[model samples]
Target: MAGSDIKQSLRKLDFPLCARDALYQIEKLCTRPGKQMELQIDLMSEFVFGEIERRRKRNVPAAIQELQLIEVQSDFFQSPGGIPAVRNALFLSLYPAGSPRYKILGNLVSLAITIHNKAVLNAAGIWMQQLGSTSQESVGLARHILNDYFVLTSKSVDRLQQLPILTPHFTANLLTAIGEVYKDKNPPTEVLRLIGEWINDNPSLLLTSLMDNPALPTGGIPMTPITPIAGLFRWCILSPVRTAAEGSTQNEDEQKLYSKIQHLLMDSVLRLKSSGSNKHAISAQHLAATTRALTLVLQSFSNIEPTSRDLAMERLAQAVSSAMSANCIYGNKQELLLLLQSLSYQHFLIEWTLQTYSTKAV
Candidate 1:
């Protein structure tokens, strides 16, 4: 329907729901073919933005998210004796973080960024952090926020830190995604700084990553989400960090930040190799991640650091060699040999060890 026609139909309906149903109908319209939507997109977008902004008159980051704060849809959360606000009802009922209607928020966030709207940018971290939001919701918002942050100059780097505390699963995925996004090139100081901060905040973050879930009431094992650790390794070791971010003020020593990140990655590797208990043991899938990270770490160190190169090599070799023993119990010898053989091209050591280990296992 035409914009005017849609409005006329809405006018014919009852009070609060009339406004809501109008927005809902627009939400449905958005999912149709893009070419057809060109006519109505602007009209619908303007209506949603204008109506919400006018009703809330939000002037600050906190105020911008006032609508989201009302998690439930009810009269108690609305204005007294005024036209009942539809935002709470719309957000809670009509649209969830996963539904097609959720795209509206993504659109609004993009437009806000294009115009340099600082308050809305900060508000994203807050509203997206609402507890009980599943990994799907957090990842959706985080991808948009991080992707946008990539285009920002270093002067606005502080905005990266303002992202509220995310769940561990979300954080893990974010770290891995960062690696892929920058896979083809060197990461700048701004990106490195963000990675370092995340590593510092999460203790034993990588070491415990691949373990299983806790036992259930029926006595099942306690578990953590099982995901490929290769991405984490790539995020940490495959890429080099620049001495400084492009166009940065050169105020802080970014190379030092890189060192901190390397140290954290190395420590996590050590934890994985040294801890012999069931809690630290890896399953068959984790071997791929471990091999890739180990290969990249040794390779990356040869290029990135000089002073600790020999010592890191020594400690890592002994620890990893011990982890690879038949009695190690993390993964069986057959799996390890096969995994190493597949990764033989990663390093000369892998090729040589795979040949020798294959002989022994056979």
Candidate 2:
């Protein structure tokens, strides 16, 4: 009869009931023995939030302080085994995993924040480790929960980038999600390796996409060193040198062939600068542009070059130091300065020994 009466009273009570009465009821339920702890917990949370809203409406400091205190206490309260009776009851009745009030659902934002926190990364890592296990049913459940959490959170990519264990999963997931978001009709790669393959297979397409901007004005081949051209040139120069050292080619014949290719590039640069074939001239121009840009960048290579024995080294050092202080490396600023000082002094002396053998014409 009392239970029926209580239910009737609860139904009759207006939502957002009198704050004083609500607070009193909530507090009493929280303190009383044999009370349904879940009801108390949920009611308390709601009441506290209500009080916070009320205070915020009135600009009440007391209400703000109370809300902050509640948040702080609740952080610790939500830990494992704080109030299992209340937690279990709430988890089942209101806050079930998918339920709006379930602890997992209720604190989705908080869980994401915890997942990203460096101090708590290990804890999250444990959760991920447990999730990745094949034998555990909880693993699949936890993985789904985390995947949802990551998808919803704004900091998902940043968090995943920071977490080494999640890097592979996040990269794969992000590419798919990005493709969907942009409606990328043809998505690129499942992994970074696959990205390299795509680039290798479709180099001209990659170049065209990058260079197709209206800002580029593709009426004729651009005379100016554009970013796309410069990037390709830099990669071409650096890639072979870095990759083709010892085990790069299949056999000695291939190595010798590549070595001849290297001599050809340098020879072409010199010949282009002197004789000025359109393609080779453009190549030389790019080299000059790059040297001008990177003369100052070479300061980062201070350990590689020493000033003790070489006068050329000392002059180069001074030019680099001046460029560093000025913060300009491009457009012949550092290059001209270095050339006027160190390079102008070097005299070129070339000698070639030619051996000729007379052979009968075939």
Candidate 3:
């Protein structure tokens, strides 16, 4: 069928048929090699989206199904040229949060991860931002998507390692998404374990990415080097691992993972402290990010035994004191003072609590 005829037919049909025929024609045209074919594909996309909007209130399921089919069956939506339309269609179909079609939205997210295309990853990031505002009915679907995301990325560590080259925004988007999931009161342990394993395998990549504030827009990106720090700190503070029953012991693997992260955090602080030379000056942003990350590291030690936690705190305190003594030529002194004051308050509370318990024992 000619492109014009397909467009006209799509306009006349209702719901699923309009979407189904539009996808079929888009697929067919996408395979052809020419500028004219490209133009035709674009035309079909417009018609498909228009029909989606026209029928959305009347038949959201069909529109959502069309997006899911396109995402699953073809790479067109994953390609750079088609991402915007695909993204728009997906967003438009997500409504009346009570709809049972959220599972399909979750599947679409999984498909995007499977495609591992940068454009699609961005679209998925956008979807996640939208999904956050949805009702409780969507939580299960959101969790499913998070689990799938972790599983997929865990299986593709090498691919993820090369993400900066293959898909520049993938790492950022993935980290942002993980940070979002961690916002929940009880994030899935499986997801957390997978993240720890991935970090264990690629500590440098993950840490450096987390620390480096990319120049991308923050609209859909949730992990901004500083924002996630507080969430992570809260995770450490609330984790049962921090206040296990007396004599409870962590598995050897878990201990090692925690130890590795601790080492990485210290290493990061050392790097930040030693970064500037006479010829160069560290920026305020870098200083703030490094400081916040260090604070998070200290909070994370709450998961360790009391003795280990005390020792880690002592070492961290000394390091912070030394860094402050140097009077690094970056960031406002008042900001640094506030950070130190905050740390001091947390340390005092911990110490006071320990002393009280010791006195009670005596």
Candidate 4:
């Protein structure tokens, strides 16, 4: 086939893996170092730049169409060399460490997984490693896939229970993504097992991270409506802490850690309550995380008879309630109610119940 004819043919496939091998051989021939080689370079550069411009104009899916064009032409470039050349620009566009495109870039990772492109998928994983809270928006389905990939795509969460908490971002993302899987109407069992394993892996990281960064909100707070870890944290908060009440000789280290976590929760809620940027930008994900953490602290101490726990819960409740009041004032009632309802059922009720239980015990 002529060089132009070969290029046209390569531009036709949606996926690279599906193209015929013979076409690849012909494409290599088109690259022989001669007069036509210069023409080939110009043609390829024009195509790539044009694709980039088109993507800029129309949005990412259009960009995906162009990527498909690249895939068809993959034979023209050669696997590692050609594939990355075609992939680099789009990869750059999609995974900026702190860019606004972080969320959409995550969706693109999802699409890459859908196409079974392991190379691109791995690239996405590496990109995520460099991001921080800035990439929380990208932690939905893409997170599940990446987590699975890291765990060798484990069939059961219990099967991979020993994974370490590598980063706060990953920890936050995995927690919420698992929440999503469990919150789904059908409720995938794999998700529960996965979460069970995750909890086993680093039950303390969430608390520790929050204690260290009191400004951090709940995972997937405003970003997602249903977060499993948020629910789990709620469970932890409402449930009594046996270690505290059983006269089990509470470890000082554990106590201090828990106390710091509580302080962080209080701080986050206070930020939300103060009005302005923190409250105005308070997404559901952040609220969920904050509420859950605060609630956990409340529940852990509920087993004790000390007036201190009561005072702490009271202050935390006021902080959250104040935040909600401000949120409602600003007309962000959806999340305001979410926080309120969780507080009403999960945290406040526990305090009330604890009071009654303490009176009876005494």
Candidate topping lDDT: 3
**Greater-TM-score candidate between 1 and 4:** 1
User: Model 3 segments beyond 4 Å from truth?
Assistant: 1-9, 13-74, 80-105, 125-142, 149-168, 183-190, 200-204, 207-241, 245-249, 272-305, 308-362
Residue-by-residue lDDT tens digits, candidate 3, 1-362: 76667677777876445655665565455445532555454544455444234445454565565674555433545544443543433443333346555555566655655656555555444443344322253345446666565565556433334444444333434544454455434345554454555545554433343444332322434332321222232333333333342235556565444454445434434444555521112233433444465466556554556554454344444333333433222345345444544455556643443333322221
The whole-model lDDT of each prediction reads 0.43, 0.31, 0.45, 0.40
| Top TM-score hit | 3
Clashing pairs in 3: none
Worst 10 residues of 2 by lDDT: 349-358
lDDT accuracy of residue 198 in candidate 4 = 56
Q: Please, what are the lDDT tens digits per residue for candidate 1 over residues 9-50?
A: 765653334545545565455445542444344433333333
Per residue, candidate 4 scores C-alpha lDDT tens digits across 253-326 of 44444344344434444444444433232244544454555555556555564443443345445433444443
Model 3 scores what on Cα lDDT? 0.45
What stretches of model 4 exceed 4 Å from their correct place? 1-172, 184-190, 203-362
TM-score of each: 0.43, 0.22, 0.50, 0.33
> All candidates: CA RMSD in angstroms?
11.5, 22.6, 10.5, 14.4
Q: Is candidate 3 or candidate 4 better by TM-score?
A: 3
All candidates in order of TM-score, best leading? 3, 1, 4, 2
lDDT of 1: 0.43
Off by over 4 Å in 1: 1-102, 105-142, 152-156, 162-169, 183-186, 204-229, 240-259, 272-336, 342-362
Ranking by lDDT: 3, 1, 4, 2
